[model samples]
Target: MYFEKIDSLNDLKKLSIEQLKILADEMREVLLLKLSSHGGHIGPNLGTVELIIAMHYVFNSPIDQFVFDVSHQSYVHKMLTGRKQSFLEARHYDDVSGFTNPDESEHDLFCIGHTSTSISLACGLMKARDLRQEKNNIVAVIGDGSLSGGEAYEGMNNVVEVGTNMIVIVNDNEMSIAENHGGIYQNLKLLRDSKGKAECNFFEALGFEYFYIENGHDMNELVTTLKKVKDVEHPVVVHVHTIKGKGFKFAEENKEMYHAGPPFDRKSGKYIYPLDNPESYPAVTAAFLMEQIKKNPKVAVLNSGTPGGFGMNAEWRKEAGSQYIDVGIAEEHAVAMASGMAKNGVVPVLNVYSTFLQRAYDQLSQDLCINENPAVILVYLASVYGMNDKTHVGIFDIVMLGNMPNIVYLAPTCVEEHFAMLKWAMTQREHPVAIRVPAKEFISSGKEDTTDYNKLNKFAVTRHGRDVAIIALGDFYTIGRDVADKLKAECNMDVTLINPKFISGLDTALLDSLKKDHKLVVTLEDGVLEGGFGQKIASYYGTSDMKVKNYGIKNSFPDRYNVEELLIENGITVEKIAEDMEKIIG
Candidate 1:
């Protein structure tokens, strides 16, 4: 096998044209086997096999730097590098990360997971190269989906000023997680239709020499085009139009579903562990949004690129029609646009993953919160149970949005409370509201929440007890409840359990009351302890006689960690917390 014969890029360079073509087929087979078993970016990696191969054939990597935007599509790049064993063997499947990691190989220049950063990163490399008097080519491989981000535009606008060798390969598959959106996509479509002969060129307008390859899958064409711009003295954009899910028929047909997914059956193209949960947050949210859209025309749902992440699938998007807006991969624009929508009269519900939400902190602070626009921002996967990747961890959102002024950050423990908070946020015009959507399993209180969210910072005393009080926020409430039960049964201690729904503000009266009877106050939050909800509580009782013990994930970017192990390490387990509380109480 060509794949077995080749260990590194040097071995790959030894192959003939026919041998390389055979190797491409071999690579695709390996990718499918690994992805179908391990589960990752199937469509993206499949589509980029030939493109990556051509690039590697033309340029010497580790010397000629490659920066992949988002890096989800860098699996083939990893294989071409020295990390092929990670994909070849199932036992070593997880040896390398899903994204491009500099530590994994010298070929990967940056460890990027978020979108629209390659061009800017490449620019920096190019600048440093010139300063060091180096002559290597710096290539930035960015998807058309990423082109919509403001940073990409900023990068394009500035890269021309460097006046050096920088190549930006636009992987146009007419997709950005879901379908591509925004005005720039229209230009991409125009370019695709005109087949490189279009007069109205976006890259050329930005002062970059532009080249287009209609058939990006053609290895010969790709190699020829890449060689022409290998050491070009000016900034250039090589727009390559390739199929998103090229090799797999199912993925080609259902691009969005297969963009990234769980382990699936190769023959039938079905998920091995299918998500059939009707009570899932995504499923529930979609139903709620549909009902709300039918009731109110002013109600709108906005997502940046990842519509499927928030359960806004193709059917949902079509049904919602004008009510739903996929703002491409531009989180900053989505936030600012939500603010604009809320400024008028529309109740814009912006649904974003917690990791992606951090990209628009400036917009959240200045545009949304500063203006006090009553936009409903639903933050998905804002817990330890969310994304485990360091770059995409949802643990930081509590510190990111909870500390912001004029923003009512609500954390609901169950479906009932989440629905209540959502209903309240939709109708309220007093302040901008953000709901931390529970990332854990769906739990139902079995009763409709009657709490008036308008009366903000009101802590709910779920269980009335004495001596020890456990104040939990969001997904961590279950842990607090378990801890309370453990203390009761094992230690024979009656513990007061409280749920702090509001993260941005504290219930001062409730806290003061807790200090009256409770000796030790333990705050549980499914986020970083530093600058988080737990820290806020700890700080409140710092000078007082009340002892506050905060339980949370520490201030570290943990990647692909076991949730149970991580919790135990942080002293967040029921038994550990109970034992600690008893000692503290004594």
Candidate 2:
């Protein structure tokens, strides 16, 4: 087998064009096997097999630097670069991360996981190479979906300024995580239709020599074109059009669903572990938004690009109609647009993931918070239970957004509280509001939340006791409750359990009240300890007589960690917390 004969790029270089074609098919089989069992980016990786093969054949990696945007499609690159065992053998599946890691191999230049960063990163490499007078090609592989980002344009605009050797390969599979959006895609479509003869070329306008390949899957064409651009002096863009899920019939038919998913059946493409919960946060939020859209024409829901992640699927998007606006993979624009919409008497709810939301910090502070536009931002996956990838970790949002002024960052423990806070945010006109949607399982109190969210920074005293008070934020409330119960059962101590609804501001009255009876105040938050909710509490009581113990993840970028193990490492387990409290109380 061509694949069996290959161990590294050197081995791959020995194969003939006809043999390389056979190798591509072999690689797809392995990819399907690994992805079906292990789970990862299926379609993105599969579509780029031929392109990555051609790239490796044409450009000498490690010598010729390569940067992959969003790195999810780097699975094949990893396999080619002395890391095939991670995919070939199930026993070694957990050895490598899903995204590109510089530590894993020399071929991967950066540990990139986010979108629209390749061109900018490549520009840095190109600039440094020119400074050193080095004669090696610097290539950036960016997908067409990433063009919607502001940074991509900024990179394109700047890459030409250097006027040096830099190659940008645009993998146009006509998709992001979902289908493509924004105005840039129109140009891409035009270029494709006109067979690269389109007069109004976006890349050409950006001062780059542009080349388009109609069939990116053609290995001979890819190699031939890539050879021409190799070591060329000046910026160049190689636009290649290929099918997203090339080898898989089901994946090609359902591109969005197959972009990235859990383990599925190889033949039928049925998910091995399908989502069983209909009342998930995404579903619940989608239902609530639909109701709001139908009731009020002014109510609009906005997401950057990942509609499925927010539960705004095809059906929901169709139902919401124009009220649902996807700004593509542009989080910064989404925030600013929401602010403008809110200022013009339109109620805009911008739903985004916590990791992606951090990209729009400036817009959140300046456009929304500074103006106090009353724009509602629903932040999903903002807990330890969220994304585990270091680049996509959700633990930093509390610290990032919580510290911002004129923004009420609310954390809800259950569905009831979430709905109440969301409804209040939609109607309120006093300040910009952001709600951290719980990343844990759906919890229902079986009662309506009648608490007036307008009276901001109010702490809900769920269970009252003495000596020890546990103040929990968002998804960690359940853990705090368990700690309290453990203290009660094991140590026979009645511990007070408090749920702080507001993350940004403290309930001063309640804190003062707790100081009177509680000797030790423990803050539980599903985020990093530094600059987070726990630190805020600790800071608040720094000059006071009250003893504060903060529990959260330490400031570190942990990748693909087990949730339970990570919590245990951070001293967040019920037993560990209870044991510590017992000693303090004694």
**Please, what is the TM-score per model?**
0.99, 0.99
lDDT of 1 by residue, 173-255 (tens): 99888988889988899999999888998889989999999998888889889999999999999999999988999999999
Candidate 2, which ten residues in sequence have the lowest lDDT sum? 269-278
Indicate the worst ten consecutive residues by lDDT in candidate 1: 273-282
RMSD (Å) per prediction: 0.9, 0.9
- Candidate 1 is scored at a TM of 0.99
lDDT per residue as tens, model 2, 1-586:
7887788789988889988899999999999999999888999999999999999998999899999999999998998999989989999999999999988888888888889999999999999999999999999999999999999999999999999999999999999988788899999999999999999999999899999999999999999999999989999999999999899998999999899989999878798987435789888898889998999999999999999988888888999999999999999999999999999999999999999998999999999899999999999999889999888999999998899999999999999999999999999999999999999999999999999988988899999999999999999999999998887887788888999999999998999998889999999999999999988888888888898889999999989999999999999999899888878767
As a whole number from 0 to 100, the lDDT of residue 39 in candidate 2 is: 89
> In candidate 2, which residue ranges exceed 4 Å CA deviation?
none
Best by lDDT: 2
Whole-model lDDT values for every prediction: 0.91, 0.92
